[model samples]
Target: MIYKALGGDGAAATVVTAAGDARPGPAVELHDPLELLVPDTEDDYRLTVDPDTGHLGFTSTTEAPYAILKADPYLGARRKQTIPDPAFVVAHHGGPAILERTASVLGCDHRQLRHSWDSLRSQGNMTSVSVLDVLARTLDDPDGPRPGEEGLMLAIGPGVTVEAARLRRT
Candidate 1:
Protein backbone atom coordinates (compact mmCIF):
# COMPACT_ATOMS: atom_id res chain seq x y z
CA MET A 1 0.00 0.00 0.00
CA ILE A 2 2.80 2.39 0.80
CA TYR A 3 4.74 1.53 -2.35
CA LYS A 4 1.60 1.78 -4.44
CA ALA A 5 1.07 5.34 -3.29
CA LEU A 6 4.58 6.27 -4.29
CA GLY A 7 4.35 4.89 -7.81
CA GLY A 8 4.55 7.40 -10.64
CA ASP A 9 4.83 7.29 -14.42
CA GLY A 10 7.15 9.57 -16.33
CA ALA A 11 9.47 9.64 -19.33
CA ALA A 12 12.36 11.76 -20.61
CA ALA A 13 14.62 12.10 -23.65
CA THR A 14 18.18 13.37 -23.93
CA VAL A 15 20.76 13.51 -26.70
CA VAL A 16 24.02 11.64 -26.35
CA THR A 17 26.86 11.65 -28.85
CA ALA A 18 30.58 11.12 -28.83
CA ALA A 19 32.75 14.06 -27.80
CA GLY A 20 34.43 14.01 -31.19
CA ASP A 21 31.21 13.55 -33.15
CA ALA A 22 30.27 17.21 -32.68
CA ARG A 23 26.69 18.04 -31.86
CA PRO A 24 25.82 21.71 -31.48
CA GLY A 25 23.97 21.96 -28.17
CA PRO A 26 24.28 21.94 -24.42
CA ALA A 27 25.55 18.73 -22.88
CA VAL A 28 26.52 17.22 -19.55
CA GLU A 29 29.55 14.97 -19.63
CA LEU A 30 28.92 11.79 -17.67
CA HIS A 31 31.87 9.65 -16.67
CA ASP A 32 33.00 6.89 -14.35
CA PRO A 33 29.52 5.46 -13.89
CA LEU A 34 29.63 2.83 -11.14
CA GLU A 35 27.07 0.20 -10.19
CA LEU A 36 27.08 -2.27 -7.31
CA LEU A 37 24.76 -4.68 -5.56
CA VAL A 38 24.77 -4.63 -1.77
CA PRO A 39 25.73 -8.09 -0.56
CA ASP A 40 23.15 -10.22 1.31
CA THR A 41 20.45 -7.58 0.90
CA GLU A 42 18.72 -8.61 -2.29
CA ASP A 43 15.53 -9.42 -0.44
CA ASP A 44 15.32 -5.98 1.08
CA TYR A 45 13.39 -4.95 -1.99
CA ARG A 46 11.91 -7.49 -4.37
CA LEU A 47 9.82 -7.45 -7.52
CA THR A 48 7.98 -10.70 -8.11
CA VAL A 49 5.46 -11.99 -10.59
CA ASP A 50 2.63 -14.19 -9.50
CA PRO A 51 2.69 -17.44 -11.45
CA ASP A 52 -1.06 -17.82 -11.43
CA THR A 53 -2.20 -14.22 -11.90
CA GLY A 54 0.64 -13.08 -14.15
CA HIS A 55 0.82 -9.85 -12.21
CA LEU A 56 3.85 -8.02 -11.08
CA GLY A 57 4.28 -7.07 -7.45
CA PHE A 58 6.79 -5.11 -5.42
CA THR A 59 7.69 -5.84 -1.84
CA SER A 60 10.08 -4.11 0.51
CA THR A 61 11.12 -4.51 4.07
CA THR A 62 11.77 -1.83 6.69
CA GLU A 63 15.47 -2.39 6.08
CA ALA A 64 15.23 -1.56 2.42
CA PRO A 65 16.16 2.10 2.81
CA TYR A 66 19.12 1.57 5.11
CA ALA A 67 20.59 -1.01 2.73
CA ILE A 68 21.98 1.86 0.67
CA LEU A 69 24.39 2.62 3.51
CA LYS A 70 26.18 -0.60 2.63
CA ALA A 71 27.54 1.11 -0.47
CA ASP A 72 29.06 3.98 1.49
CA PRO A 73 32.57 2.53 1.65
CA TYR A 74 32.81 2.25 -2.10
CA LEU A 75 31.26 5.65 -2.68
CA GLY A 76 33.48 7.22 -0.07
CA ALA A 77 36.59 5.73 -1.64
CA ARG A 78 35.61 7.00 -5.06
CA ARG A 79 35.07 10.49 -3.70
CA LYS A 80 38.48 10.44 -2.00
CA GLN A 81 40.32 9.04 -5.00
CA THR A 82 38.82 10.63 -8.11
CA ILE A 83 35.46 12.35 -8.01
CA PRO A 84 35.51 15.92 -6.86
CA ASP A 85 33.16 17.36 -4.28
CA PRO A 86 30.11 17.96 -6.41
CA ALA A 87 28.51 21.35 -6.75
CA PHE A 88 25.20 19.54 -6.82
CA VAL A 89 23.72 16.07 -6.44
CA VAL A 90 20.97 14.47 -8.52
CA ALA A 91 19.57 11.49 -6.68
CA HIS A 92 16.63 9.20 -7.39
CA HIS A 93 13.32 9.93 -5.66
CA GLY A 94 12.90 6.53 -4.07
CA GLY A 95 10.99 7.98 -1.09
CA PRO A 96 11.56 10.05 2.02
CA ALA A 97 13.36 7.29 3.89
CA ILE A 98 15.56 6.31 0.97
CA LEU A 99 16.43 9.94 0.29
CA GLU A 100 17.37 10.49 3.92
CA ARG A 101 19.52 7.38 3.93
CA THR A 102 21.21 8.39 0.68
CA ALA A 103 22.03 11.81 2.09
CA SER A 104 23.53 10.25 5.19
CA VAL A 105 25.71 7.95 3.12
CA LEU A 106 26.86 10.80 0.89
CA GLY A 107 27.66 13.06 3.84
CA CYS A 108 25.43 15.79 2.52
CA ASP A 109 22.59 17.72 4.12
CA HIS A 110 18.99 17.37 3.02
CA ARG A 111 18.93 20.87 1.56
CA GLN A 112 21.44 19.71 -1.03
CA LEU A 113 18.85 17.21 -2.21
CA ARG A 114 16.12 19.79 -2.79
CA HIS A 115 15.53 18.82 -6.40
CA SER A 116 15.07 15.16 -5.51
CA TRP A 117 12.67 15.98 -2.74
CA ASP A 118 10.74 18.35 -4.99
CA SER A 119 10.42 15.65 -7.61
CA LEU A 120 9.18 13.10 -5.10
CA ARG A 121 6.62 15.50 -3.76
CA SER A 122 5.40 16.58 -7.17
CA GLN A 123 5.52 13.31 -9.08
CA GLY A 124 5.83 10.53 -6.53
CA ASN A 125 8.43 7.91 -7.56
CA MET A 126 8.94 7.29 -11.23
CA THR A 127 11.12 4.23 -10.64
CA SER A 128 13.86 4.01 -13.30
CA VAL A 129 13.04 7.51 -14.49
CA SER A 130 13.02 9.17 -11.08
CA VAL A 131 16.66 10.17 -11.26
CA LEU A 132 16.16 11.45 -14.76
CA ASP A 133 13.35 13.64 -13.56
CA VAL A 134 15.50 15.00 -10.77
CA LEU A 135 18.33 15.61 -13.20
CA ALA A 136 15.98 17.50 -15.41
CA ARG A 137 14.92 19.65 -12.49
CA THR A 138 18.49 20.26 -11.45
CA LEU A 139 19.41 21.33 -14.94
CA ASP A 140 16.48 23.69 -15.03
CA ASP A 141 16.92 25.15 -11.57
CA PRO A 142 18.10 28.75 -11.83
CA ASP A 143 20.57 28.21 -9.01
CA GLY A 144 21.70 24.85 -10.31
CA PRO A 145 25.19 23.76 -11.28
CA ARG A 146 27.12 26.04 -13.54
CA PRO A 147 29.33 25.25 -16.51
CA GLY A 148 32.58 23.49 -15.51
CA GLU A 149 31.16 22.50 -12.15
CA GLU A 150 31.05 18.87 -11.06
CA GLY A 151 27.97 16.95 -9.98
CA LEU A 152 26.98 13.44 -8.89
CA MET A 153 24.12 11.16 -9.86
CA LEU A 154 22.88 8.42 -7.54
CA ALA A 155 20.08 5.90 -7.76
CA ILE A 156 18.99 2.73 -5.95
CA GLY A 157 16.94 -0.17 -7.20
CA PRO A 158 15.84 -3.71 -6.49
CA GLY A 159 18.59 -6.05 -5.24
CA VAL A 160 19.60 -3.02 -3.19
CA THR A 161 21.66 -1.96 -6.18
CA VAL A 162 23.50 1.33 -6.25
CA GLU A 163 24.08 3.27 -9.48
CA ALA A 164 26.26 6.34 -9.42
CA ALA A 165 28.15 8.55 -11.82
CA ARG A 166 30.29 11.64 -11.94
CA LEU A 167 28.77 14.47 -13.97
CA ARG A 168 30.30 17.66 -15.30
CA ARG A 169 28.38 20.57 -16.72
CA THR A 170 29.66 21.35 -20.19
Candidate 2:
Protein backbone atom coordinates (compact mmCIF):
# COMPACT_ATOMS: atom_id res chain seq x y z
CA MET A 1 0.00 0.00 0.00
CA ILE A 2 0.99 3.72 -0.35
CA TYR A 3 0.00 6.80 1.65
CA LYS A 4 0.58 10.60 1.32
CA ALA A 5 -0.46 13.66 3.28
CA LEU A 6 0.22 17.44 3.50
CA GLY A 7 0.31 19.00 6.93
CA GLY A 8 -2.81 20.97 7.59
CA ASP A 9 -3.95 23.06 10.67
CA GLY A 10 -1.18 25.57 9.92
CA ALA A 11 1.11 24.12 12.55
CA ALA A 12 4.76 23.13 12.21
CA ALA A 13 4.19 19.98 10.15
CA THR A 14 5.65 16.64 11.05
CA VAL A 15 6.32 13.85 8.53
CA VAL A 16 5.24 10.18 8.91
CA THR A 17 5.04 7.10 6.63
CA ALA A 18 5.17 3.27 6.38
CA ALA A 19 4.36 0.33 4.00
CA GLY A 20 2.82 -3.18 4.21
CA ASP A 21 4.34 -6.50 3.13
CA ALA A 22 3.26 -7.51 -0.39
CA ARG A 23 4.45 -11.12 -0.45
CA PRO A 24 1.57 -13.54 -0.96
CA GLY A 25 -0.21 -13.79 2.38
CA PRO A 26 -3.56 -13.53 4.14
CA ALA A 27 -5.42 -10.20 4.06
CA VAL A 28 -4.20 -8.11 6.95
CA GLU A 29 -6.27 -6.18 9.43
CA LEU A 30 -3.67 -3.66 8.38
CA HIS A 31 -2.78 -0.91 10.83
CA ASP A 32 -2.71 1.36 7.83
CA PRO A 33 -5.89 3.39 7.14
CA LEU A 34 -6.80 0.96 4.34
CA GLU A 35 -7.88 3.87 2.17
CA LEU A 36 -4.49 4.78 0.71
CA LEU A 37 -3.90 1.98 -1.76
CA VAL A 38 -2.21 1.32 -5.13
CA PRO A 39 -2.88 -1.54 -7.51
CA ASP A 40 -0.64 -4.57 -7.08
CA THR A 41 -1.44 -6.00 -10.53
CA GLU A 42 -2.02 -4.84 -14.11
CA ASP A 43 -4.72 -4.84 -16.90
CA ASP A 44 -7.32 -5.06 -14.13
CA TYR A 45 -7.83 -1.52 -15.40
CA ARG A 46 -6.38 1.16 -17.67
CA LEU A 47 -4.62 4.50 -17.11
CA THR A 48 -5.34 7.55 -19.23
CA VAL A 49 -3.15 10.63 -19.10
CA ASP A 50 -2.78 13.16 -21.87
CA PRO A 51 -0.23 15.80 -20.89
CA ASP A 52 -1.26 17.87 -23.88
CA THR A 53 -4.76 17.94 -22.42
CA GLY A 54 -3.39 18.64 -18.91
CA HIS A 55 -4.03 15.16 -17.60
CA LEU A 56 -1.65 14.07 -14.85
CA GLY A 57 0.14 10.74 -14.85
CA PHE A 58 0.54 8.53 -11.76
CA THR A 59 2.08 5.15 -10.98
CA SER A 60 0.98 2.61 -8.38
CA THR A 61 4.28 3.00 -6.54
CA THR A 62 4.28 6.81 -6.80
CA GLU A 63 2.07 9.44 -5.20
CA ALA A 64 -0.68 10.75 -7.45
CA PRO A 65 0.34 14.38 -8.07
CA TYR A 66 -3.19 15.30 -9.11
CA ALA A 67 -4.32 14.16 -5.67
CA ILE A 68 -1.55 16.20 -4.05
CA LEU A 69 -2.51 19.20 -6.18
CA LYS A 70 -6.18 18.89 -5.24
CA ALA A 71 -5.62 19.39 -1.52
CA ASP A 72 -2.65 21.73 -1.88
CA PRO A 73 -4.77 24.87 -1.56
CA TYR A 74 -6.37 23.78 1.70
CA LEU A 75 -3.58 21.54 2.85
CA GLY A 76 -0.49 21.17 0.65
CA ALA A 77 1.56 18.37 -0.94
CA ARG A 78 0.43 15.35 1.17
CA ARG A 79 0.49 11.51 0.64
CA LYS A 80 0.95 8.04 2.31
CA GLN A 81 0.09 4.28 1.91
CA THR A 82 0.31 0.70 3.25
CA ILE A 83 -0.08 -2.90 1.91
CA PRO A 84 -2.07 -3.54 -1.27
CA ASP A 85 -5.88 -3.88 -1.62
CA PRO A 86 -7.85 -5.42 -4.48
CA ALA A 87 -10.21 -2.45 -4.86
CA PHE A 88 -10.35 1.15 -3.52
CA VAL A 89 -7.60 3.46 -2.25
CA VAL A 90 -8.11 4.37 1.40
CA ALA A 91 -6.98 7.89 2.49
CA HIS A 92 -7.53 9.89 5.67
CA HIS A 93 -5.77 13.25 5.93
CA GLY A 94 -8.33 15.32 7.57
CA GLY A 95 -13.19 12.76 5.94
CA PRO A 96 -16.06 11.80 3.16
CA ALA A 97 -16.35 15.29 1.57
CA ILE A 98 -12.95 14.96 0.01
CA LEU A 99 -14.08 11.79 -1.69
CA GLU A 100 -17.23 13.59 -2.75
CA ARG A 101 -15.29 16.43 -4.38
CA THR A 102 -12.74 14.13 -5.98
CA ALA A 103 -14.32 14.47 -9.40
CA SER A 104 -13.57 18.20 -9.43
CA VAL A 105 -9.87 17.73 -8.86
CA LEU A 106 -9.07 14.37 -10.46
CA GLY A 107 -11.37 15.08 -13.41
CA CYS A 108 -13.08 11.72 -12.88
CA ASP A 109 -16.12 10.42 -11.02
CA HIS A 110 -16.64 8.37 -7.85
CA ARG A 111 -17.38 5.42 -10.11
CA GLN A 112 -13.77 5.67 -11.16
CA LEU A 113 -12.95 4.16 -7.83
CA ARG A 114 -14.81 0.96 -8.68
CA HIS A 115 -13.49 1.11 -12.23
CA SER A 116 -9.98 1.12 -10.86
CA TRP A 117 -10.68 -1.94 -8.77
CA ASP A 118 -12.36 -3.84 -11.58
CA SER A 119 -9.53 -2.95 -13.93
CA LEU A 120 -7.10 -4.69 -11.64
CA ARG A 121 -8.94 -8.03 -11.81
CA SER A 122 -9.88 -8.44 -15.45
CA GLN A 123 -8.95 -11.51 -17.49
CA GLY A 124 -5.33 -11.65 -18.62
CA ASN A 125 -4.76 -9.72 -15.41
CA MET A 126 -3.70 -10.97 -12.02
CA THR A 127 -6.48 -12.42 -9.94
CA SER A 128 -7.73 -10.40 -6.96
CA VAL A 129 -8.63 -12.65 -4.09
CA SER A 130 -10.30 -10.50 -1.43
CA VAL A 131 -10.67 -6.88 -0.34
CA LEU A 132 -9.83 -5.70 3.15
CA ASP A 133 -9.93 -1.87 3.02
CA VAL A 134 -10.94 1.08 0.78
CA LEU A 135 -11.15 4.74 1.92
CA ALA A 136 -9.50 8.28 1.69
CA ARG A 137 -9.30 11.58 3.61
CA THR A 138 -8.40 15.31 3.22
CA LEU A 139 -8.85 18.84 4.67
CA ASP A 140 -11.43 21.48 3.78
CA ASP A 141 -12.20 24.74 5.54
CA PRO A 142 -15.84 24.98 6.52
CA ASP A 143 -16.03 28.59 5.27
CA GLY A 144 -13.60 28.06 2.43
CA PRO A 145 -15.19 25.84 -0.15
CA ARG A 146 -17.98 27.12 -2.36
CA PRO A 147 -19.66 23.72 -2.23
CA GLY A 148 -17.57 22.43 0.67
CA GLU A 149 -14.13 20.90 1.18
CA GLU A 150 -13.76 17.88 -1.04
CA GLY A 151 -13.69 15.19 1.61
CA LEU A 152 -12.24 11.73 1.29
CA MET A 153 -9.43 11.26 -1.24
CA LEU A 154 -9.28 10.19 -4.88
CA ALA A 155 -6.14 9.27 -6.81
CA ILE A 156 -5.31 7.74 -10.18
CA GLY A 157 -2.60 5.12 -10.14
CA PRO A 158 -1.60 2.65 -12.90
CA GLY A 159 -5.20 1.41 -12.85
CA VAL A 160 -8.47 3.26 -12.49
CA THR A 161 -8.90 6.09 -9.99
CA VAL A 162 -8.03 4.79 -6.51
CA GLU A 163 -10.38 6.27 -3.91
CA ALA A 164 -8.60 6.98 -0.66
CA ALA A 165 -9.66 8.40 2.69
CA ARG A 166 -12.80 9.73 4.36
CA LEU A 167 -11.50 13.25 5.12
CA ARG A 168 -12.20 16.05 7.61
CA ARG A 169 -10.61 19.39 8.70
CA THR A 170 -9.83 20.79 12.09
TM-score top scorer: 1
Q: Give candidate 2's TM-score.
A: 0.23
lDDT of 1 at 65: 78
lDDT of 1 by residue, 66-140 (tens): 877878887888865656567889999688988988888777777779999999999888887889889888888
TM per candidate: 0.88, 0.23
Off by over 4 Å in 1: 1-5, 21-26
What tens-digit string does per-residue lDDT give for candidate 2 at 1-170?
A: 11112111122222222324333322222232222333333443334466688653323422333343434333222332221222223222112343344434444455544433433333111112111122211111123212222333334333433434433221
Q: List where candidate 2 sits over 4 angstroms from the true fold.
A: 1-41, 44-142, 145-150
Candidate 2: lDDT of 113? Answer: 47
